[model samples]
Target: MSLADLEPNSLHVVLHVRSHPPKANDFHWGLYLHRDFEAGGTKYHLKGADKRWLADHGTTRGVFKSFLLIGLCQVARIPSGLMKDVDAMFRTYDHQLNEMPGLTCRTWVFRVLELLQKPHSGQVLLECNDLTSLEYELLSWGNANALAAADCQQPRPTHRSDLCGL
Candidate 1:
């Protein structure tokens, strides 16, 4: 859907997952924030090849194309007013690869989720409560989809629903 379709003063937080490599169950994570029509949103994701996170202020379609998205772990509705705050939080969200344990796209996505789940001005940003459950859900989906595709020698999932069972 186009940005115009979203409700005023709100945006969508989509947690995306894709196969990492070498192993089917190994997965990477990313986020897509779709804001209202006026303030175009951005994508915060890690490029496995570069081993660093990249934020792209490009068209939603273009970002999705580059993501090679496999599944959506979760979709949340957040107030559009929090856009700048969230972006700033992302920019300053301490991500020291050397100090981190097994740093990957998943770690970055998890940190983002932790930030979003915090109460902002007494208002919770994301609808989710438990981050562990969210991770488990995504892991389950990845194991099923990734392993199936690898074993069956099937093409990558072509539809959004195919990946997440949404």
Candidate 2:
């Protein structure tokens, strides 16, 4: 599903590769943090052992953190629950980040709707098999409706003359 499906105030933290040029249109994976912890906090600390630990797990961790910085700058607001989900997602992927020695990470917030309008061109779509059947159905319906509306013509505005300048 497109990032636009996220709620209006949903917050997303993003990061991108510094070596790559930014794009106008793209979808990037974002980490949604809990609202209570949305503001800046104690800095994330990764050292030699931690880095080695992550590397031992896989490559995705480092990739995820690098991208978090970019998404965070684009987010405006985020729902509390979605934020929690993001934090949990990060923890789930922490192993990947721990492997990168001397790598840096940053964070920011923006309106979910706004970010979706200008997503990173290099972003990747993640498959969410965790969604319930009903949730999936609803998402499908919403996407279909949005597509149909985008293709439809707008109704013309009608003119009226009740009280002309006196």
Candidate 3:
């Protein structure tokens, strides 16, 4: 279904998983998403929760794309709770990665988190095996374009200082 089919208040959850073992110096990570709530707050149900293992060098770029698509369908803010959820997910998967010890998995977690938090400004390049350059570019470009357009529509301050004839 197209993004238009989604509910106006619907949220998108993107989970990024790493596959390889961790190195002597690396951290494992993951990503998740949820709907933004009003001041009253909202609840998320994890029904039918399941886990899927990713092969070596899996890209979390898809999650970014999904968020963009959902955002495009309807304008919405990222909920505070959703950010907490993403952090918690990272912690959990980090622990899991520690047990198995995959270098690739350990490294990509922070990269994915960085992308989710700040797509365009993220220091981590999506060109690495962990993420697809195409998907990363698409999501980053989409977000940048949307933000630029929105900024253009906003009113700029025209009042100048020294109006009192100093």
lDDT of 1: 0.53
Query: Which pairs clash in model 3?
Result: 20-102, 21-101, 21-102, 21-103, 22-101, 22-102, 22-103
lDDT of 3 at 70: 18
Give the TM-score ranking, best first: 1, 2, 3
Question: Cα deviation of 116 in candidate 1 (Å)?
Answer: 1.4
Per-candidate TM vs. native? 0.64, 0.24, 0.22
Stretches of candidate 1 exceeding 4 Å from the true structure: 1-24, 37-40, 48-59, 94-98, 147-166
lDDT of 3 by residue, 94-161 (tens): 33433343434324443443444433333221222323432343244334344323333222111111
Report the lDDT tens digits of candidate 1 across residue range 1-166: 3444444433332433344442544665666666656754566665544445444333354432343344333345555577778767665544554355566667777777777778887776766677677677666666666654434342333222222222
Preferred candidate (lDDT higher): 1 or 2: 1
Per-residue CA lDDT of model 2 for 1-166, tens digit only, reads 2223333333333322222333322223233421222333211222233245321112122322332223222223433434443343334435556544443332111122223333233331222222233233323333333322233322211111111110
Better model by TM-score: candidate 1 vs candidate 2: 1
Q: Model 3: what TM-score?
A: 0.22
Name the runs in model 3 displaced over 4 angstroms: 1-77, 105-107, 110-130, 134-166
lDDT of all predictions: 0.53, 0.29, 0.29
Model 2 alpha-carbon miss at residue 13, Å: 4.8
